[model samples]
Target chain A: MSTLSLTTSIVDATGRMLAKYTPREKINWGRLGVISVPSVWLFVFFFVPFLVVFKISFAESEIAIPPYSDLMNWDAEDTFLSIKLSLANYIFLFEDALYLDAYWSSVKIAGVATIITLIVAFPMAYLIARSEPNKRNLLLMLVVVPFWTSFLLRIYAWMGFLNKNGLINQGLMAIGIIDEPLIMMQTDFAVYIGIVYAYLPLMILPLYTALEKMDMTLIEAASDLGATPTQSFIKITLPLAVPGIIAGCMLVFIPAVGEFVIPSLLGGSDTLMIGRVLWDEFFQNRDWPMAAAVATVMLVMLLLPIMLVSDGQDKKEEA
Target chain B: MKKTSKFLTSSSILGFLFLYAPIVSLIVYSFNSSKLVTIWGGWSIKWYGKLFENEQIIEAAMLSFKIAFITSCLAVILGTMAGFVLARMGRFKGKMILSGWISAPLVMPEVITGLSLLLLFVALENTFGWPAGRGTNTIIIAHTTFCLAYVAVIVQSRLSMLDETLEEAAMDLGAKPSSLFFLVTMPLIAPALVSGWLLSFTLSLDDLVIASFVSGPGSSTLPMVIYSKVRMGVTPEINALATLMILIVALGVVAAMVIMKRQHRLNKELKE
Candidate 1:
């Protein structure tokens, strides 16, 4: 039968492919197979999606099912392929003050939050790293334990603490500190608190790693030379920990710029963040192309910091 | 030095208090008898009971767990293979591209990732008529895509730090390549694998934004449900649920620390 002949040919092809490699070389093929699994998976799901976003960003918005017009269409009557593309979305993003303000505020807020987190986390990391060797791991574990809990719940907890009748207000009143509750919830202050609280662990770990690995002998030598402790810290410790500082800052800043949940939950309606803008454009207005444009721009903005962090990591690995 | 030590100790205490205060308050309010989360009434277990009775929340939690479990398992397998390849295979073609592909998702924002993946699913559905519609399957794929990056990084670092001579010695003893891997490399990397799995599981379970994009009508995860509710305002039931989550996570962390400490002591004793 024809089916039998086809099956034989299929088997013949595979046998020929296998025969191309010697027994020892076949292991190399297996290695290829192993490496190919994740590479192919990432290519299909991660890389390809980004390409899809790029493609869709050039298309026009439509009321159709997918909510975006196809870039290429087949004309049935004329029997010809037609391509349609527009730069209006990108132009609109540039022209609109709302989008501009969102980007500006996102960077400003994330930057401030990152700086505050570093100021708080630096001393904490130094203390942990400088602790007795036997006790250091316990301190490190305490820092990491908070990170294991739910992020959303942590933010929600902040909401409770910041609300009008919340604990912070009640505590202040009970202690006769203030007669009125400070306007904290649904404000920019709350967003900063949520971000700083959530990202503190991230900022601490790298700093701890850097500080722990520092040479105590250098500090001791500096002190022996009659340099003050503060002077030695500034002269030696600060310079050595720059890599960690940069790494922690980028780790906090990059994601914080594109953050949605914190701003949405904790920020006031007047708060303008690009992540919220993109969400609204896509989900509310059903403007896929415009949303894609926003995201693409956001990615471009974040690209430099991301590369800096990754490059720093590579250097650290090399060292 | 004494003055500096005092400063360090006090600062460390304040830092920890800052970190834990909100969580402690959240837990305390979960026991409040009143529906309002801020107003303190007499203590009661009513919210815990109410949380159990809510069928929607129960269903959502189960779905989130199911997705996380499946995502972590797949991520571990794929990630381990990728990690092994990166650690062992040196100076290969496209190495830079491969490494870049592995690390890119780590820094990519969740919103952009979600948007792009959503578009991919839609386009694929339209073209191939497969994956039919977005739901749990789509969410799993999206989650695994990101989670695998974390697992790969962890496993890769662990593998690089390991001594490769053990594998070579195994081979010299006439062990086959596959067996050498299973009996030697796997056992050595078992700790890394466990940690990687736990990290992936937590990341998938904690996700809200990416899940929101890829999930469909009937497949809402627990975070999605909680997010919708939290948007309106906090409720006693949510506080109760959060407390339970915190307790479970705290227990897991404590157990892990205890085990790690025991292992450390055992290693020291063996060396001595």
Candidate 2:
């Protein structure tokens, strides 16, 4: 009995030592550690940054130096004084019809672009998804390969195609399709083309994922029951694909609302977006507080919808 | 049936043409012997020569590469750790919030993300007296913060598909947990890690908005240089640079795909 007790104690001592030398033994501990790193990083770089911007939104706007200079005034004790924490910036947004107009224009453009992209990408996604498996891979590769290039380069390439003396205009004039060079660049139509070209892949990816996961057997069974092709599609395929549609729409719409590069490159000065406005305020006008206010508004609008969709998605996944 | 298939084929062709036409024009015009970007002269390598001679563009390109390499490496590490926990460990309190925050930047507006980071830097400088000023380091921090989401999502998805039994078997063999991770789990997820790293690298290299916000004077990235230059006047030398970039990226993708296919086939044969 004494030998048995001695052996048990020996094992316990070694196990304790081993546990001490190793990482946290509790699963919760390790998980928490893992969660904490990204959480802290996000809190510092993302969440806190936004909070800082929100603080700046309440600050007084002063520009003496060049753009990208100090945004706030600090006291001897390191307390911020410029952030007067007033309602002036928010109030300014309400009174400024131009800002409100830009926001509405951005929303309308994003909506129109999402619908157009859906129309274009849906057919392409459908074709790719319904094709033979071997061929589908190559086709999807073709779709994604363009995204490898710098996004701005793609927009630059569009300028070559859309300018008055550019390829499209040149081709049309040379072929007698038009009497004169067409003003394709710096137009809202050009903006539409630029955005649709850029974001079409975003739309296609989720749609393809949705279509790939769909059970063809169900569709066949529906058809075997004497239902029409469209009926089978509507009943079996559409419902299952709704998640992808939502995901795709959100992906496209959110970015389109904040798109500045496309608008600046392809559209006229009248092309108004919140992103462009924010950029002008920060970089051109040197109004950091006003820029922060614009950014805060965008963040608020996006956060609510994202949370709603994500919660809905989580519930669906759980079900 | 033939008629319908023909229609579908034509539409696909048209879509492909629409996508490829601009790219082809850009490439062709890169070699044009003309100063004007729109009008093409005889084929020549003059633009390519000019592209190499431009010191500003070359410097920006090098900066972009250096930043991309470091950010991708760091992002892949943290993302892998987070993904391992999310996939292997069961849920606890704040799991939902944790996941949400992980993916929030993936969909967040670039302007907001950039603006917010700028604000953070300004605030931090005033308070901590560290990070001295924004430059390469700040740009890297901002890039890593956002690109980590892509890496995490990719790793999490891959881990979900991985067989958990392998890790269990390793543990049962009395292998230490740390050794088990390095020896078993890492080897299994190495492909996902590679792809995630590549994705993050490309994203960092391509980013203009966030980089613009965080980058300081003389730390101008390739896209920034190109943007400022193009805004002044579009040039053929940029076309040459763009074409070269497209070529390099295409090669990378094709190589990755070939390797992945071979790996898949080998795995299949072993299973059989």
Query: Model 1 over residues B150-259: C-alpha lDDT tens digits?
Result: 88888888888876898989989999878988999998788788878888898899899999999988999999999999998889999999999988987887787777
lDDT of 2 by residue, B31-114 (tens): 889888787788999888888999999999999999999999999988887677556655444555556667677778888888
Clashes of 2: 0
Clashing pairs in 2: none
Q: Which lDDT tens digits does candidate 2 get at residues A1-319?
A: 3334335546665676576546755454654677688778877887788788877787767644323334445786867476336678789998999789889898898889888888777767878888886888899988888866678988888988888888888888889999989888888898888888888888889889898888778977898899997898788888988877888888888888999889989988889888999999888978888899898888787876667555543444334
lDDT values of the candidates?
A: 0.88, 0.81
Candidate 2 matches the true fold with a TM-score of 0.90
DockQ of 2: 0.42
lDDT of 1 at A70: 91
DockQ of each candidate, alpha-carbon based: 0.49, 0.42
